[model samples]
Target: MEPSPLGSVDKALLTLDALGRAGADGTSLAALSTEVGANKSTLHRTLAALRHRGYAEQSADGTYRLGPAVLGLASAFLAEENLPALLRPALDALSAEVDELVHLGVLAGQEVVYLEKVEPRRAVRVWSAVGRRRPAATTALGRALLAAGPLSAGPLSAGPDGGTPETEAALAAYTAPGTTTDRLRAAVDEARRTGVATETEENEPGIACAAVAVLRAGRPLAAVSITAPVERMTGPARDARISALRELLPTVLPAGLAVPPAP
Candidate 1:
């Protein structure tokens, strides 16, 4: 048998649960007492304790309701979650449906760091690994993230002195020999207009990719990309691959995460 819960803790939790069910209007002290099956005096003490800890609030009309602390705790829990672990199932299903390599990445300064990857059964695969970082300007994943709002200088920041333009210049110095700042800026703009980003051999030779941002509260929390050989990703086939990502990715995303709507 499970150990019995402590009386004080149990009472507090039961009161909280009751308040939650009571909704935004809150509940009267008498009603809460009846629901918890405790005497008015004991229930009052419990309510007082809950209020002291910020777990419950009393309205001007003397009704009790859930408090801001509950939301704070929820936000803290979400912040501590591991992104790769939370989204693995979705990544796996997407790779299976598209039969191509899928990558999950986050922006780190001007680069995108790969957090998770799912590979298909084909012998030919994109050369990528977890923890590897790539230029945000040259890769589809980074461009998708950049396209979503809330960059340090704002999305596709065009200020001459800083933001995307400055980052583009810095990226150009060390990126693949042929990649140019103008081309990278254009890719980001395209992503903003089209709601997806694409790269052709910009990150690696013979590789092509398409990506979409995973958004939270209107900001890009991460990005997902489908990578394949250049031949398989060009012409009409490229359109099909991109369509697959837009169509299939949303189906497997967990609650609280979403892809931008098609433009």
Candidate 2:
């Protein structure tokens, strides 16, 4: 059956999504109109409604961004769900065992938003924060989420030539050799097969991460990762960290969770 036409409210939501993809710099009215393919006058009215309810905000220079209302909604959801209450013990255990930084994150559109950070004392410091967003194609956590998702076993070769500028930079920034597209494809394929993904100095210089998805009933709930400095993550150390994660996955995930059949 054909989908129904979008209502006024739905159009406004489409505008909202475009605004989010614009990021911290915000989006101009003309760009938003172009993005949504709506007439300028109609988009103006839609944005006006969003602005009136605090769901969107126009800056002094006429760029729009998500407003406080979205943050309020996110805060309420996080508080009510209390994810830390359910996962802190596992995070703490992993952080203590590995003596490094552990993170829990979930996919938000094409980015992964960090939900929590467990930092081991005296570990190499990093700038990752509780709400920071990182591109999914570059980070271990994001790759794990994508691998466990419906796109499992899919190829990344069909994108625009050389990928995005940001993606190109990440793909080229690996410390050691072998950051080729073939290597990335093999890693992602392995992640889909094993539920684990690894990234080395791709997201940030001097850091390496290994991640595994936290699944409930065969659906990805979030991704958990252990990150350490490059020096501390080489050879034997890297193998041990990966081993520790594999050993802990069943323990951390809820017991008796259903495993869905492959499509």
Top-lDDT candidate index: 1
List clashing residue pairs in candidate 2: none
| Best prediction by TM-score | 1
Model 2: weakest 10-residue lDDT segment is 254-263
Model 2 over residues 1-263: C-alpha lDDT tens digits?
Answer: 55438678677988989988898799998999999888899999998989899989999999999888987865564451466566778888888888989998888776788889899987475778988888776788877877777445334442657555554444344312324555655566667766678888887789999888777646777788999998778899987888767886456554533222222
In order, candidate lDDTs are: 0.81, 0.75
TM-score (all chains, Cα) for each model: 0.70, 0.56
- On residues 132-178, what C-alpha lDDT tens digit does candidate 1 reach at each position? 98878788998888778433243544565645655655435434444
List residue ranges in candidate 1 displaced over 4 A.
1-81, 150-178
Per-candidate alpha-carbon RMSD to the true structure: 5.9, 14.4
lDDT of 2: 0.75
